[model samples]
Target: MKWKTASTLALLSAVSLIGSACSGGSGSGSGDSEEVKDASAKESKDPVELVFYSMSRDSEASFNERYGDAIRKKFPNYTIKYIQRAQGSDLPDLINAGTRIDIHWDSIGSFPSSNMVYELSYDMSDLIKKHKVDLSRFEPSLIDAMKQLGNGAIYGLPVYNERMALFYNKDLFDKLNVPYPQDGMTWTELDELAKKLNVEKDGVLYTGFSPSVNHLFLTNQYSLPLLDKSAMRPTITNEKWKQVLELQLLQPTQNPVYQKAMQANKGKILDLNQFAKDQSLAMFISSPLMPLVMKEELSKFNWDLVSEPTMPDAPGVGPQSYPGYFAITKMAKDKDAAMEVIKYLTSDEYQMECAKKGIMTSLKSEEIQKALGQESAFKGKNFGAFFYNKFPAIADKTVEESQVPILATYTKNLNKLSAGEMDINTMMRTADEEASKLLDGLKKK
Candidate 1:
């Protein structure tokens, strides 16, 4: 999940209910996206081109195959060039090239701290209204979600926000002799299963658990704020923060992946796929997108998804990074044209179309629900947590403001602790202290 797609990996898979939950099942989706644009749009005399940039993440090909050529077919007046940013700094370089870079991807969270972007992005409220776009068609929770981003402007919007749910390998569950759990499984139960499944082998140990933890969601699970609004500094030493760290510490012996390998073998990177691919690991706590990774890597192994265990057998409000909307760029030379693109993309027709691609659609329209509800493989399971979920997730306002470096440093140490280099208490204290210092530094700057 880029910034929006980004956090689904962090909170949902690892914890119970950290993102917005969208319920889907009944709706109409347009099978064909033939442009229903005005005759004026079709009869335009001159050809206009829109140069756009995409993060071009792994899922791009599927999106392009469905969305790209069809969009061109619908809007023939505009020639669209997509620059895939496969590596670093292509955005600024491209903008410098005067490519008319009309549309670009901006993770609002990354925009503020970068300084290079504020001057470039367009304010889209007017464009949104002028196009008679139906902002109400989206999930209502997202309105405030935008407020948490760069200066509270709708600089960029996501087609759909991402929410995470736990993804467990059913084959691993069978191998470990553990049973799948229901949505409200207690942490104690999850840990008990982890204890049984985790095996220590030649210098390494791998098991069914790990937190793709980040401060915004993980810390917040215990009700900790990234910074105290009044104090404006890292306040992880508080009760909420303590609880957050304690949850991760509870499973001292488990690693997210590599159940068959041990620390003596020195596996530094214990990722979600370990359980999915390595088979050494039995379960992965991650976002819905984990399936995409699993589908590609562990084709032979049968797998399933489960939701994160709720705290004390109660549903927890979490999972960060719900996908957002697609807004018109202020820098857009043709605001009307850009809004049309966004309108169409966010419309019921387009979103429902996107649903068939295995990527969940955030549209509140009937079509989106029907598509998702019908996706049996991606939906809930018997005795397993709901695989694809929508929950109230924390948006990364901190990261968007360049405060992510603060959390990044903290998470790195947290990972180290999971690897058994340090005790949880020591890691927590150290991270809390250092994060506070970083926050202070940011304020001074």
Candidate 2:
């Protein structure tokens, strides 16, 4: 399970919320069962009922159907069962029982890890050494991040590794006679592109959210060099952070990207998918799961994802991590079997299938070639560049770091206040003030 969590359920809820915007970071899973099995299990035995736990119902169901058909029919000795939930389900009580709970998939740095899980369940060094698994298969940064977290030990396997990219609709691009984004566009370049595409004449708006200041992911990446949290102080006065805030206040005359207020502060009802459905906006910064989200909202609009603009002088490799992984509890009865389940889900073969379906995976899935094989909305661009491994784990020690509070509780409520129902300066001040108090309270505890 991930070490950071606002709630046990936040990770689950995040999956659906960003299901289209963030790549899958949580590991896949099914249930809690009795660890004990019949002693003579190896011989002419009944299929092993493997219980799994997970938050993704659709992806897990698909994996079980495809993988189970191939393996189970051939071996006829394994059966898989899954237990799915929305984010925030309290699962410790179930695991505290003697139930096997074969495996659980969750976000790495985002899911709650305190009471539910930790870094100790996995013995990665042994498994890699014994299995002869090639660490070379993964990029160096990912391996380095793991080592940093586990005191230089491989703690767990990643299932849904992800980062943000600019996904723009091609229909609008053609209509506006604008060029698509190339690699390494600076904030200035993004502004020009948006200006070229801003085609709002008869109430129809065509603009770029490409480098929108309001987007936290884009702003964060742009400021990574100055805001490493490792060496820098958490000062709001930092110019880079102020630029992030400026992104939210779109100056249409300068940048042409359409601005849709899918209020994170007001607890606004419109989801990302809903905003796309309205078709008033053009580009959106989202995850690989964009296709899944588009299944409902996209129509007549051809869209593709591009690597997010990197910091001018920052050293991150590429593709920012969104944080998710799975683990077994020290309290489990069938710890061995539970661990086996984790191994299977994180296996490259399973991850490959997920990537082909455009389901974002954390493991370095081979299926990515399948996505890259065809002509795309990106026109032979290296989409994989957005996912390059990291240089170091994020070291933010802010209030959001201590606890993964409900993003909407604070962000949403503030949006309502900004719509002239309240005041912007007052709203921001209140948030900083309230958030500070909350952080101090958590520290005391």
Candidate 3:
């Protein structure tokens, strides 16, 4: 995909001169070799536009403000292009239109469905070695997840990470005279706390806790596999899966107060909005992006975070790492330059900046973790909760796992379970059967 641009022409000339000088020609001095190396480095940073594509639907202006500006400042010669999904520039659309995407970015869970499915993933192992990129600098789980997704090949570098945390409304807890949630609390203890805070006050039914079910399932601490790849079937009816459902969903909704609240709200899940805006939720288990996403509403309330509640079996282990990665695509016009850009994005300097902005860093650096949210308006908040717990190992997602719409089936059964129409065992069995049917349909297709 290389273009015959002026920089390429100059690079070719530099290579020829360096080869001539190395062959015992005139001007074969060490100084000449150093000059040639410097010239090559400069040419590598020459003016080349890279188009970034993601299904995130972030606006160009937002991307520029968050990352594009820093990238441009770092490599002034390079042009940055962001293809917004909102502009109908999806991977399929770009491919059909012959658009050359240099980089593809998305959460690790999405790579199988998006980049790999479209055959846009480019193995960056050779480039990673060539650039001397230190994979050890990042959280091992993030790197391990990338390799797992690529079947032992490095296809991407993690730029940032997110994880589930227990965000509690300080005001609601104070009103109920309940002590705050402490880090390392087990799910059983958290459930008791939720029960304490689930009372009605001043005509408003304040719920104790609500987890983002999708996030919980995606980052299940049990490292449960949704699909049994060998048999190419859903694995939702396993004992571990049953335990997760009992702990996360059925047991929580079994509370009469929570169930009444759900019925009152017309079966709507008590989500982030209830915690941030309505102020009726006492605690929420969600991503650390909450403060950034609900800046204004969150500013009006008194909230703090603790480590995500753990299972009794997995004491200190939190959810799996949910990281966003930047990968060089197969369609990149200049793979070397693309590699350099992604490497910079994962470097200590940029990662620290991201942390200061309240974005979780993918790096394992203690200094970076300490600096998190320092530059943000909520600097005084409990940023430590983001890294307080150990991340569980990531489970490998199979091809069938990505192809089957099993999560939808789970969500449907969860609704039934929430309304007390089905028991936990029945819900699991129904979800498994439905998911298997969906998988069968896909196989037939």
TM-scores for all predictions: 0.76, 0.68, 0.89
lDDT of 2 by residue, 1-445 (tens): 3213222223222443333221112222211122221221232154456665654443554445534343343335656665554344335445444445555555544433432333225545764443334566554445655555555666555655555666667767777777887656654456667667656656555545533222342225532321233432223334554454444232222322233333321333222442355554456556554444344455445766566654444544343465456555444445444444444455455555455555455555345534531232233534564554232343332223326342322343333442335544554455445555555565578
lDDT of 1 by residue, 75-175 (tens): 66767666566555365665576655566554334444432233555667766665555567666545555655545666655565455555666776785
Sorting all predicted structures by TM-score, with the top scorer first, yields 3, 1, 2
**Residue 8 miss distance in model 3 (angstroms):** 46
Residue 161 of model 3 has an lDDT of 84
- CA lDDT, every model vs. true structure: 0.51, 0.45, 0.75
Q: What are the clash counts of all predictions, listed in order?
A: 42, 41, 0
- TM-score for model 2? 0.68
The TM-score leader among the candidates is: 3
The regions of model 3 sitting more than 4 angstroms off are 1-44, 86-88
Superior by TM-score: candidate 2 or candidate 3: 3
Tens-place lDDT per residue, model 3, 1-445, is 1212212112211111111110111111112245543543575567889888876666676667666776676667889898878555777888999999999887776678888888898999998876667787889999998888888988788887877788899998988899999998888888888888778768888889876777656788988767776787777777887777777776667787788888887886677667877898898876656666556778998989988888999888888877878889988999988877777677777777677877778889999898887877688888888788887788777666776677777767677777788787888888889998998898889
Instruction: Compute the lDDT for candidate 3.
Output: 0.75
RMSD of 3: 10.9
